[model samples]
Target: MTKTIVITGTSRGIGFELVKLFAAEGHTVFALSRNDKPVKGLNLDNVFTFSCDLNKASEVSEVAASIKSQVESVDVLINNAGQFLKQEFKDTKMEDVKSVYETNVFSVFDLTHKLLPLMKESTHVVTISSMGGVQGSMKFPGLAAYSSSKAAVITLTELLAEEYKENGPSFNVLALGAVQTEMLEEAFPGLEAPISALDMAEYIKDFSENGQRFYNGKLLQVSSSTP
Candidate 1:
């Protein structure tokens, strides 16, 4: 059974690895990233690479519309793209905070909203959040905008799951711990993570494909480190 999967932030890290993994498994994948070249460079037989800036609602809507026109139904949609702002709350500007939300919260809503028509009852929506976003978790310094925006999406996923529980398309959010990715390097320089990007992607790939059978509209804390 082949499935069509749509994933954002496909240019690098876990999203990039997931794209390749799914393509290798012979699934159709719509890969969205600001720089499409990375996935496009793969030239996978089943992948449709799109250059998209999630910060812009129009771009997210356009991508969803394009995907809607092509796929009969979306089996899974992964909101993997995120904006990280490593600034203290006192020093962070209003524009910086808005930019973070534009990608983390607003874009997730826009893409999911537009793509709902293409998702069937069995479809699964997986959103990638952060351990920092988890309430009462050990707070990190200089991530007020980024962490809060992630929290917003977590709530959004929960609400969407409840609203669609009677219908279909299970929604879930993953609060991830430290993973060795470019984003991690940027956020915490010289820090080593127990998990690699590929490792985490493998977990998410499996979860996106089968986790809905066991859980919906739930937040799963996926961290190897204490948070």
Candidate 2:
């Protein structure tokens, strides 16, 4: 059966790859992002793109209307949009922290809250997180704002899982390690990531469904190292 999957941050990276992966499988995919379209050379007719700034709550409402107009229910929801900043705590401004939370943490809540009615009983909510949020792990020095926002995501996922246990739709978090993508490159200039964005996207597509089937309120960390 063809599933309806909704993914955020489809402008690039893992989200872009996921749009292709799921659409090639003949699933109906809704790609949401600030950009008006998918990245160049990644366009697919199976994937419908919605342009909306997630940081703005009003835009999210408008997009929700657009989504509901087309699809009656969602099988999978991937909250993958995020903002990252590489700056020491002392150098990171409060505004940067607020911006990171706006995109990374709060936007997930806003969009998920609005889309809950469109999700069926078996819908899965997968939010991308980072290993930096893991306690006692390899906590990098310069990612205070980014890491904290990811931590908030993890906690929020847990809360949502429990909050909606009786209602419907499962919630899970994938706390990924550094993946080789533009976002990782921007944060750590020359360092190499053991996992590729394409590979992670493939894993996420399977895990989102499988995790929702067997697990709830769990945080699975994917990494090549302890971090």
Q: Write down the lDDT of every candidate, Cα atoms only.
A: 0.93, 0.89
lDDT of 2 at 205: 95
Q: Candidate 2: which pairs clash?
A: none
TM-score for all models, in order of appearance = 0.98, 0.96
Candidate 2 residues lying further than 4 Å off, grouped into runs, are 39-43
Q: Can you list the residue pairs that collide in candidate 1?
A: none
Residues 1-227, candidate 2, lDDT per residue (tens digit)?
99999999989899999988998999998888888555434667777888889999999999888889998899999999989898888888999899999999999999999999998779999999999987767888888999989999999999999998987789999999879899988878887888898999999999987788898999998888644
TM-score of 2: 0.96
Q: How far is candidate 1 from the true structure (C-alpha RMSD, Å)?
A: 0.9
Q: After superposition, how far is residue 43 of candidate 1 from its true place, in Å?
A: 1.0
